[model samples]
Target: MEGYLDIIIRCVSVYFFMLIALRIFGKQELSQLNTADVILILLISNSVQNAMVGTDSSLVGGLIAAFILFLINYIIKKWLMKSTFFGSLIEQKPEILIRNGRSDFKMLSKLGINSDELSEAMREHGVEHIKDVKLAMMEIDGNISIVTTDQNQFKETHYKRKHNHKNLQGEN
Candidate 1:
């Protein structure tokens, strides 16, 4: 019984440690899992298994540890959903990359996103130029969203600007 209790404590400790580690590392890690990420996760699970089960190695002991982990995870999720402060601590806010044809260079630099990458995202949304974008946001989930005016609407605005400029030149 004492050994089982120790296993429970160790499992909980490991769980919290991992949660904090992931939080500090940033939510981007969870958004994309490349080969290295997969390898790291595999190694982490293998390394922590011993700490969780300890010397017990019994089926019941392993099951107990897993059950406790699941329960704690459920509770944490519930708490996060109910508390805005906790949610903000664990979750990232969306970032605006471009707005009304203007790019936020500071935000792009802070997020480690280069113009080429930003252009790629724009291209993915069928936008050929940054000037054509009305708004581009990097969502909290690490996906880029682009908003653009309709082609016909943009054309009308462009024509109106050209006509207005010609009239001003004629008056001058």
Candidate 2:
């Protein structure tokens, strides 16, 4: 019983540590994982496995740790959904990159997004020029959302592109 409690405590501590570390380091990578991100995640899991289960190599010990992690994760997610402050701490707010055909240069630079990246995103959304974009936002989940006007009908439409825009500076 004592051993199981120790395992649960260790697992919970490791889970929270990783959660805070990812939040500080940037959650953007989770939304769009590259090769390095994949490698890093694999390494992190391998490295933390021992910390979570300690020296207890028993299958039951490992299962207990895994169960605790899942429970804590579910609880945190539910709490985040209910608490606005906690949600903001763990998640990022969407940022406006372009508005009314004018690019938000300040926000673009702050987010470490280059013009080329933005252009590529626009192209993916069938927008040939920045001037054609009515609005462009870097969403919290690391996606670029582009709103454009249909030239023929003069109506607004939204398009999504998978991309990462780092950091944030309020809305435009």
| Best prediction by TM-score | 2
Question: Residue 88 of model 2: what lDDT?
Answer: 89
Instruction: Write candidate 2's Cα lDDT for 68-154 as tens digits.
Output: 999999999999999999998877788999997999999888777788778877766778888888989988776778888656643
The lDDT, on a scale of 0 to 1, for candidate 1 is 0.74
Model 1: per-residue Cα lDDT over 81-131, one tens digit each: 999999888777888999989999999887666776777666656678888
Checking candidate 2 for backbone clashes, the offending pairs are none
**Clashes in each model (backbone N, CA, C under 3 Å)?**
0, 0
TM-score of each: 0.78, 0.83
Q: Rate the local accuracy (lDDT) of all candidates.
A: 0.74, 0.77
